[model samples]
Target chain A: MAKQFDQRKETEYSSRDLETGCVITDPGNAARYKTGDWRSQRPTWNTLRCIKCGLCSLYCPEGCIAPNAEGYYEADLYYCKGCGICSRECWTQAITMIEEEE
Target chain B: MMTGKRIGMESSLGIAEAVKLANADVVAAYPITPQTHIVERLAELVANGELDAAYIPVESEHSAMSACLGSAATGARTFTATAGQGLELMHEVLYVASSMRLPIVMAVANRALSSPLNVWGDHSDVMAVRDTGWIQMFAENGQQVFDLTLCAFRIAEDPEVLFPVMVHLDGFHLSHVVEPFYLMEQDVVDKFLPRFRFPLALDPDKPLTAGAFFPPGVYGEARRAQDDALRSVRPVISRTWREFEEISGRSYKPVETYRADDARVLLLTMGSFSETAMLAIDQLRERGQQVGLVRIRLWRPFPFTEFRQAVGNAETLVVLDRAISYGGPTGPVCAEVKAALYSEPKRPRIVSYVGGLGGRDILVSEFVEMIEKGTALAESGVEEELLTIGVRV
Candidate 1:
């Protein structure tokens, strides 16, 4: 029941249909909410300097960074809030924050 | 009516006993005047092993309420007490408790707010957090204080209604008064208030986010949900009172009336002054005046339907407020009463009065005089924005 409710957008739910106290009954449902829309700057990673160390993934504030198929660390833009934490924490400066285009 | 022992005890101590009887799991509170005695007694109960509960001595009222929120989230039967400035300090956290739908019961010994630093009884503190979304109720005397405090837990923890409850008794006036009242047995109380089991309690096995932030897209809906939930709690409150009446032989209502059947003039009051107003009504009736009294018991949901019915037939209503709205309508309660009756076809002519402020006494004779003045004002059609009683100036 909770998972089904989580699948619907917040705006789609009416006051009567919402859970009591607006409590999110489903745990770890934050993954469903794409907080990346709030980001003005997106992270870009250089594969050469990445070294597959996964430091950027560990430092990502939103925990949206992960190792891609090639073992290079990449930020999942769908959930990243453009905090630039990964860029700042990258030991080799492999990640850089760039302004998003309209 | 199961006859329990009738004993005289201070109102504050009675409230503490009520909490103990309810078997509260957590009591997190800071000491403040008028409210201190209740918490002090609870602390003593915890110390003496009379009540098996945690007594957290917090640094400030803010921490006290915050601690209650945490404990309540974990499905604990939480209780606390505060007055005046302490209540003001817990202002912000008060909303969180209600919005989260935690069934925490608080006894507020209503006192005057400082500036003049008067540690006296008044409704100033109660009026300050009027819109904080708690289930607010007023207790007229020591027995009512004890009864209502017990009822608060049952009403608040009802699965249908999970709002926090505030049992407000006038500071010093009601809190310090020693009165004889029947104390319910622990076995009876245990049967009345079932073990609280919050459906959305914080548990490691079944995780859920409580009080999550709602952005602009959902904030209005969230507020609407809360408002509807609170407004719909009237039935639960009435039902709880009825169930309590069965065992306790005491009856309570949202709006209680005294000889209001054919009353042409009505005097409305709240808190401890209601009893005094009742005496004044008896005097007015003896003087051949068709007067009655109406005291508001449930304050939060406002009891619009019952209130309208009670005052609809009266020719005039004299509302005495313990707190001033300052520059606005003069009386916070008066403004609400007027608004509630604005659309009624047979509404009474309301004469607003702000009195009994900052611990000032309003004797029975004084209430009679005030009522007479109000009736005269209503009859004369004089547009006085505010009238104050017992003010020397």
Candidate 2:
């Protein structure tokens, strides 16, 4: 790990202060690390059955579900981990868990 | 001239007063033997409306330290106290507290770790957390405890060195013992330690994360950065000590030496046992034994320069450690001394002894005996790495 990104030399310490560790210089960088690749099972929201109650969004473990322009809820695959939690938690049975094909 | 109020008080109360005077914003703690008095007093102060702060009676030491991390992240001046098992329970969080650069002040009433459930004085607890990257210090008495606790905040909160600081006092030996000491007035303490201003607070307006997870790509650099910060805190510690001396008329040094000039033999100690070792040195000097004493006041950042100078040209250096390192070189302090003086041009032969475990009393006479034994061994040139003294066979 040190062989990479350790551009600073030891001599630099004499004139410079240490880079404070893991301090969030940029806000909300968690969005950059895409966890969608980890999905084996993904949740598909049935927009007609969603009822626009937002229960699927509320129950999403990864918080990847959001409302579409038509006031219906949909799953954002970018941040979803395919937890199936929203599918199980949907009282209206508006979400369905589907296996992702290799 | 003694500044402010001069009164007799226990070491625990003295530290509590120092924290109160520093005006800590949040105190989260769980009661443990030897360390209870400090937090209890703080709790009382909070309950009585004397100190306007949040007093959290956490479920456990882990929760206590976790709460401190949360409170400190919000730019609050956080304080906590723990000992022995309590410290062990909170062990994991110790790393988080320092790595996050939360400037929290922790008072550790040093105690023996329990298998036998011993709650007395020893260095086992503090030694365990040595690698946590916190600025560590040891106090010999009530006055030192009071003064150092205040200095801890200033040193930890310094913008150049935003690290946690742990002030360790021997459990029961210092904490329970009452002694006369000078207490600085609230105004004086205020002047000495300014209100801690943390640049990165968990504010709603300026949203930022404190302890973000590091990937393997940058983990090593992150650690190097933390270590660099730790190693560079000496100047800040010195400046804080100097400022404190000016305010309180009390002098403090990283490694304090006593009557060691022109001595053939030197004895090294830390925490309260250093006082007993001093008495032993005085007696040895009266008999012309040519012996001296060295007490380590600042534990972490190891004070290598001061320690080497303190040991000087002594032919024999005897280190008395309160905690054993089990099967290692001898004791924790002895191993550190040998490592620190390894490449010195004229280093003294170190004789390591582990005694005073589980609150066992290490009398002045015992210190004298250890020095004599070490001197004899040094003359013989026999390599005895570590020895346990005064233990029942």
Candidate 3:
């Protein structure tokens, strides 16, 4: 479960009148600002190859890959910065990288 | 609440005992004399299993403070001690600690700065870092050393004020001198200081970035916030002190007065010298001289209101400083005191006198002479702003 921001009566996180340091209210808010737009190459999973060894999930730098209802791991596009680490880490050729369109 | 055994002990050891009793989670320090005794005893405590804290003996003062920053960011109760050049070396990290609002407590064995390689006691080191945004306080005796060390944790960790605090003791004078002081029981310390709980911690379940870089657009706001936070901690400091007083029955104030009720001349001092100056004030009073003592215990967030009240009805205020401001002013304390009272409608003429540099003792007799000279200077309306006392002519 994601942790919630601990707000108290004493603390007033004013955007206009700041009296405290930088604080992020939403947990995992980094995902909100999608980094997929920064990608030059995108990973395309070849599910037909039929190998769920989970190496792609293990080696993913952004932790964007997770198992779907079918029990096969897929990339979370919102944060997948398209780093192709999963494609490179896959022991079986179950994933491939393709050029991201501008 | 004061249940611990009373023992005559070296002041530095008393400080170490307080840190141990506070149950500090991390202690990172590099050895520097006057300050060495504190970390040395702390190391012994950790090694002997007396303290359950991680003791990091880093290679340099810079890395020591850097380690403390990391430890504090991890939501641990962190501490470190350094002196003179060591403090100067860690000067940059000091700002990072305060700006990040890491509640790390540091004990600075106040010592004279080096050019002549002197290692004696002076306020030059502490004065050098006066504006680094850390909450600063001076301990006048062994008892204050123990109590204030413990109090620094409470003041720094309070949710209302999470800024780091530095508790200073005069080097060799307070650090090495053996004095009898009361030690509160561990249970009492626990009652006074609750378990450390940082609002922002580096927990895996609740990950959030800390000490992030601020762009030019938002940088000014961040700095202004830090300033506001420092100013806001004043009441928290008083509240923390008052609570501790209830537990220990030992009172403290930022601007403490001694015999200044009905006086024409007052001598201002700080740290351990205030006690010595009290005796001098007694001597002056015996000879029918109306004199008193005003000691500044809190350095930063400089207590302006209490200081003005302490110097009430006095015609001349003799400001004694152990550190010089080089070419700027006679003494930093004198310069600050003058600035604090500059706006008041009724204020005494400030006589700037610099003495007791590099651990040289300021005799009791010299205190009387300083009062006379200062009163004379104030009366004659001389514009001389600086005087170096005890320097060979």
Candidate 4:
């Protein structure tokens, strides 16, 4: 039906892997333990705007988000289905699911 | 040999007979062109209480597939049927049924795609969802359709297989065609298809979550489990087929080759078109053409080994695809078959074709035309005809 195509989101926020600085392979539900793929559509945070509340990590039902070596929150989006619970639950404008086109 | 009697009936009725005999717990489906009769009779049986099962009336094919998944997950045996746009609409959930490891069965009345809008028999409906992770089978006659529908449940519910099955039949041609068949008494079918059991199930006392979200760390295991399940089911499928033969006096295999034992050319097809090709093969043989036909009865978990053995030795391979791939050189089946053979050192000379678009006719005469076109191309060594056959108007 036209309704299915009508709900399409053209823009997706692209996230870069902090370790490799490469794009994530699977922004949502990517394979485990693989080379970084620019194809991943993950969300990157501006840590300065983050308050260390850990809301994003807690809200991620997929548990893809965890603390980095620096104790800063990070998301492992390979298993993320882009449910958008993370961005919606964020108190600060720090967490956002950006579209690629945007 | 166990003696049995056959009675003539429409193929859809035969399927309904088999479904009743299978003693499935749930039959849920949305009606679509060419496949309505199957679910209609099924609903009637449930209404009359002649059969003890829940016949779910669904709004759309999507919901129908979802209901089957729901019933199947609860450890209830479930089945559904659809065609053309209905199959396409259920495309998203088709993979879900397989991935969730529910052994649901579906009868797909093969039909055409839209734009011009025609409702007849073709492979376009099933072809679109070929990679949906379900086990797929194609049946030629009303008899095979009945035989394979039973075989579908056995294969799908086998602890090893734990995969959904799609028993595909040509819309109208087979779905509505009348033929002779022997209906299995409920007792025999009960012995043949046992109640489904799943090691993993949602129980109120020992609750378990399904379709849980997994991160990258855990996703691999689920997929690996699925792949391994498919591989492990090979032996189970064979055993089930043997058991079915013993119980119902019928047998089945992954790939069925006709008159190919002594031949140079092979005609490969899936669905009712194979029947047309069978007729053509007979005519071709009479005319001194060493032509044989290979029908891919089982498409998914494709009989790669059987396919190799059947077409591997042919001097010329002409694969007739009843659906178009748009930009591809071959239909979905031919492309996969070619990929499977590319690794072999002594592959047969192969030519691809795209025919019978929009459920247009793939007549026996057209198959004769396709073979002639293929032989000429083989002589000149061309890649393919790209697309041909079927009616222009």
| Interface C-alpha RMSD after superposing true interface residues, each candidate, one decimal | 0.8, 5.4, 5.9, 13.9
Pick by TM-score: 1 or 2, better one: 1
lDDT per residue (tens digit) for residues B1-393 in model 4: 333577899999888888888888899999998999999999999899977999999999999999988898888888899999999989999978887888888998888989678888788888799888888889889988988898888888777678899999999888888977876767777777777676555566655446655445435545665665565666677788888888777777777889998878888888877878899999999999998998887787877797899888888888888887887657788888889899988887777877776656678888888787787888787675375666463
Task: Kindly give the stretch of ten consecutive residues in candidate 2 chain B with the minimal lDDT sum.
Answer: B212-221
The per-residue C-alpha lDDT of model 4 at residue A37 equals 39
Ranking by DockQ: 1, 2, 3, 4
Worst 10 residues of 3 chain A by lDDT: A1-10
lDDT of each: 0.92, 0.87, 0.86, 0.78
Which sections of candidate 3 miss by over 4 Å? A1-19, A23-102, B1-4
Cα displacement (angstroms), candidate 4, residue B289, comes to 2.0
| Tens-place lDDT digits, model 3, residues B9-58 | 99999999999999999999999988999999999999999999999999
Output the TM-score of candidate 4: 0.79
User: Across residues B1-393, which tens digit of lDDT does each residue of candidate 1 receive?
Assistant: 747988999999999999999999999999999899999999999999999999999999999999999999999999999999999999999999999999999999999998899999999999999999999999999999999999999999999999999999999999999988889999999999989789869999887888887878878988999999999999999999999999999999999999899999999999999998999999889989999999999999889999998999999999999998878975999999999999887889989988899999999989998889999999999867778899986
What are the runs in model 1 whose C-alpha is more than 4 Å off? A1-5, A47-53, A89-94
Give the top-scoring candidate (DockQ): 1
* Clashes per candidate, residues 3 or more apart or on different chains: 0, 0, 0, 9
Clashing pairs in 4: A11-A99, A12-A98, A12-A99, A12-A100, A13-A98, A13-A99, A27-A41, A29-A78, A30-A78
**Cα lDDT of model 2 by residue, B6-87, tens digit:** 8999999999999999999999999999999999999999999999999999999999999999999999999999999999
DockQ for each of the predicted structures, in order?
0.77, 0.30, 0.14, 0.04
Candidate topping lDDT? 1
Quality of candidate 1 docking, DockQ: 0.77
